[model samples]
Target: MDLRIEQAGDRPAIAEVHRSGFGGEHGRTVADLVDALRRDDPGALSLVAVEKREVVGHIMFSRSLLDAPRRLVEVVSLSPLAVRPAWQGRGIGTALVREGLRRVGERGVPLVFLEGDPAYYSRLGFVAAGGEGFRKPSLRIPDVAFQVVRLPAAEPWMTGTFVYSQTFWDYDCVGLR
Candidate 1:
């Protein structure tokens, strides 16, 4: 499989991948979230995994913030990771995530946050973000699903209420606001 940055004209395939990977109404929501994010968050970093020239997986990281008392600290939020069902269990998702994080870190993003299964993201170095100095913006998010990974450039001021982009709420991200 090939892992690389998403290019123009990848929307249709990407949407299909997300829809199929997730399935049901939840899958449709995720696909719409991807579409909304692309239009609303210009700074988002998107990556795709391709096999035999067909897109099979996708991952996106978009600018978010830590709303600290004195200032807003810029961070990245990893969301909507998707791999075609037929392509699942073949490391396509892993390749997309590894490469996406690597690229975001290279861009000097100090923190990456996500709402996901601890067992799944922990393998990628994501840790619970609920301890002292960290906060989630809403009770909508499950305390356990909120995780964070501090990149090499993380700063002391990076702790605060994690705020995701409007796209997250607009898409109803599993009903978490």
Candidate 2:
């Protein structure tokens, strides 16, 4: 398997990965969310996992804001990570995430946030953001689901509300309804 930055030609396969992973309407919604993020978020970082020249997994980190007491700080939100069903148990998703985090951190992003299962993300170095002085943008997101990972660039004073890009809100993907 090969891990690399996503290219234009990878979009269709990426969408398929999400659709296959999520299924039905939610799958399509997540797929569309990926397109919107790529189009609207200039700072978005996307990565793909390929095997046999086919995309098997994808992960994205899009620009978000942290309304810190001192000032608003730039951060990222990891969302819609998907691995092809056939590739699910092979660590493709983990590789995408590890690589995505490394690439985003290299860009000087202080923190990466996501709404996901605690059991899954905790293994990826994420912790409950609420307990660390960060607030979720919506109450719909459970406290346990709102997770965050701090990079070397993060500062002790950078704690605050994590705001997702408008596209997330526009697509109604911020949290569970």
Candidate 3:
């Protein structure tokens, strides 16, 4: 498998991968937020895994923050990961995520956060690492989905409600009441 993960440069392909991988609406979530960021704070890091010029899988990082001091940090939130059904389980998504985290860590981002299956991310060095926001805000699901991975060490007290990128306000996080 000649799988290579790198910065995503194609727009149409990105949309396609998002739609197919994540299924239904917001496949173009990053594109929308990217446009919004052009307004000033572009809050997002987009990555793509390509196989022979075809974007088989994709991932996106957008700005999210600690509810306490309002500090800005990128979060591994929108995992619009899609590798054609035929390619599922071939480690394409894993490659996309591992590379994405490495890049995020190398840039001194301090930490990476996500809402996903602990069974999956925990193996990647991420743990349930945060406090119960004064208000779990409606976006949080089952309390356990909020997870974090600190790189190069960060202030141990980094805790608070996490506000997803502005674009998040545009969608009703699935299953969130």
lDDT of each: 0.86, 0.93, 0.60
In the range 1-177, model 3's lDDT, one tens digit per residue, is 444434435666666665666555554554454445434344456677777777777666655665556564444453444665656888887777787777767766666777778887878876775452222335446667667777774555555655665555664443244
Index of the highest-TM-score prediction: 2
Q: What is the per-residue lDDT of model 1 for residues 76-164, given as tens digits with 9 covering 90 to 100?
A: 89998999998899878878878988999999998998888888888988888996467886788898888899898888777888998
Q: What is the TM-score of candidate 2?
A: 0.98
List the pairs of residues colliding in candidate 3. 37-42
Candidate 2 lDDT score at position 44: 87
The residue-by-residue lDDT of candidate 2 on 67-148, one tens digit each, is 9999999999999799989889898888888999999988999999999999988999999999999999999999999999
Q: Which prediction has the highest lDDT against the true structure?
A: 2
Clashing pairs in 1: none
TM-score of each: 0.94, 0.98, 0.76
The best-first sequence of candidates by TM-score reads 2, 1, 3
Give the higher-TM-score candidate: 1 or 2. 2
User: Model 2: number of clashes?
Assistant: 0
**Residue runs of model 2 more than 4 Å from their true location after superposition:** none
